[model samples]
Target chain A: MMSFVVGIAGVAVFSVLARVMQSAARGTSPVAILAIAAILSHLASVALGIIYVPQFQYWSAASIFSFGVMSYVFVFGAVYKSVSLEVLLAVAGHPDRAVPLPYIVGHQVPEIFRGRIQILIESGLVEQIGSTFAATAAGERLAARIARLRRMFAIGDSGLYDFPD
Target chain B: MVGLVTPAMNFLPGPAQTAAICLGIALPLLLLCYARIPGIRGAGSRFRIGCATAAALFAIACAVLPGERRIDDVAGGILLLATAMLLVYVFWGLLAWGFTLTLLTTLAQAGRPLTEEQWAAAYTQGGDIGKFARNRLKLLLGSGMVAVTGDTIAATSSGMAIARLARLVRLATGLR
Candidate 1:
């Protein structure tokens, strides 16, 4: 019975995490917020499990479980946190250029409307209109064309990338 | 003649049962890693390979260790400690890498062609990346604590359930 409960709870926890991740992806909340939520939920589950199950009282089981959970949580939180920070840095137009500005900028834009030109401008990472300026210009033109196509097809924001029926 | 009835033994998994439970836990994780890691290139590949190797080594160590050892026993406690240490080590490495990535990306976006020296200085200073990484690390570490506690509870409950089910089966078969 304890196992069944744990299984059910595990499923629930993962489901909530998936939703949280999706929300983060959609820019509903910052990645940091999502990480916090995931961590809290996981902790809650662990507490509940310990309270209800005696076998977990053993040090070995508890230790292994703790380590596994910690590892996963740390990895997820760190990765997302790092990515978000990079985005902020790129946007600030700093001189140091700590991260790969292009990748950071690319992530900021929505996938369908993304382009090198917009990324460079919006991210504020690029210092000058160098040789890559042409590529940026081309990307801008492409984006404009795509936007025009979307308007012509009456596509919604979500449907911008979809083929016209 | 019937033998004397024995008191029920509860709360511990038999050797075979414990092995099965551990394997169940490890197998899914391995499969998940395998599925998600392929097709990643470059630095990502290196990270994946490192994680995989660590996981593999840990799993092997766990397998080779004696089974059915009680946590209260010194040997069991030592094994558990070792496992915990390894897990922490792997997690820390991931966190460091993640922070590094975030820092690099942010600098790149700053619109200035930064020399490596400039980048290094910015990284060392409490620049945006540094600040963000600090905040993120705290959040991740906190969340990790929660996750670890929850997983331990869940795994223990599951293992207990398996032991109970086995007990029931033994009774049904009139083995005890």
Candidate 2:
């Protein structure tokens, strides 16, 4: 019970610290900020538990606390980067709760594509040559690693949802 | 306050947690072994099978481990397994279905500079970006989140609710 309490306290600390760090430094990656906050808070929680709780069970506390932090990161990634959610949000936010197919295919999809490209550029993975783009050497190595994993897993590179016919 | 200082708190969860840790380590190994099998076809199918096998083994371990299982032990065991599952899923998603990663891979494979249109074309294996957009829309349509009517797409009620929820998540996660 004390372990669970400490774990939950760690989650709260992580959340508050993450929000504060992100607000203060917009240039840092949010994932990095959240990860740092999670690690620090978890360590603090474990230290406090060791000092206060008799017979402190490290694994029990770590399990629950890691679960909470991972779940938060999962939801955060989904909300931040899911293109399907973006499409849904776009339609839902429209005045009529609808949009023409052409608007979606032409404008919204292209905007999303460009946005991803910008992310790649910002991350130093892909470089924009005049009127064209190419992956950097580092990007190539990373891509190769991802490709090997996908091949090992028999996953396709399309990144499309497989709808059963 | 007494709860905080309770001596001899025996929530050590030793046996079950050890079992959970064993199963967690076995999960990726199971996935790799499953990949070698010709019967399992899709990545999703293989992953499901791996998780199921791990879960079944964990259940067996819980039953077989020589101790009276406490509630805290069982709960902690379950939490550890769940955390392992989520961590693997995140890594799997990144490797298999990450859009930005795919884009980088496609460009790397192309070995030449590509205009935006060319890159989209390559990404879809010669189909245009519209094909990719339609593929994503298929998920929304299949999930009943959105409906298509004659040339237009509209959000269903569930879609609106999910959108609001996504917004709330973004706000709470400091993404907005």
Please tell me which predicted candidate would have the highest lDDT against the true structure.
2
Question: Considering summed lDDT, which 10 consecutive residues are worst modelled in model 2 chain B?
Answer: B2-11
Evaluated against the true structure, the overall lDDT of model 2 is: 0.87
For model 2, residues B1-176, the per-residue Cα lDDT tens digits are 65466544444557888888878877888898888899987777788899999999989998998979977777888899988988899898877778999999999999999999999999999999999999999989988999999999999999999999999988877778
Provide DockQ values for all models, in the order shown.
Answer: 0.03, 0.67
Kindly list the per-residue Cα lDDT of model 1 for residues B1-176, writing each as its tens digit: 14423322234543433443454345334433543554542333333454565446545654676754433333333334444445534442432333332233334433354443344344445343233333332332333311123212111233334334444533332222
Model number with the top DockQ:
2
Provide the RMSD of all predictions against the true structure, rounded to 1 decimal. 21.5, 2.1
RMSD of candidate 2 to the truth, in angstroms, is 2.1
lDDT of each: 0.39, 0.87
